[model samples]
Target: MWLFVVLGAVLVLVGAVWALQGFGMLGGSAMTGSTLWAVIGPIVALVGLALIVIGIARRSRSS
Candidate 1:
């Protein structure tokens, strides 16, 4: 339960930063190569959100 929440938070933050950097919103020169985080960050964030929701629902049902 708590784990999901933590992971979700981390993912959301990482995803946001990656998305920002990837989109050049940070206003910096592009790197020589593509960064995987730009893809991974959002995916991880979604997974984390799903995990958190599932955990919450499961806990609620059990209780």
Candidate 2:
């Protein structure tokens, strides 16, 4: 439970970073020639969101 929450948070952070770069808000990967990153950014973000939702749902069910 706690582990899930922590993992979800970390995924969210990583996703946000990837998304930022993909949207051209940040540097690094955005400037690189990887269209894969551009696509992956949003996907990662969604995955992160799903993870968070699952963690919350699991906790709520337990309590």
Query: Considering every candidate listed, which one attains the maximal TM-score?
Result: 2
Model 1 pairs whose backbones collide: none
Best candidate, lDDT: 2
Q: Alpha carbon lDDT of residue 29, candidate 2?
A: 50
- Runs in model 1 lying further than 4 Å from the true structure: 27-35
User: Candidate 1 local accuracy as lDDT?
Assistant: 0.67
> Where's the lowest-lDDT run of ten residues in candidate 1?
25-34
TM-scores vs. true structure, each candidate: 0.65, 0.74
Candidate 2 backbone overlaps, count: 0
Error of 1 at 19 (Å): 1.4
lDDT of each: 0.67, 0.73
Model 2 steric clash pairs: none
Candidate 2, residues 1-63: lDDT per residue as tens digits?
767777878877877777677667777653444566667867877787788888889999999
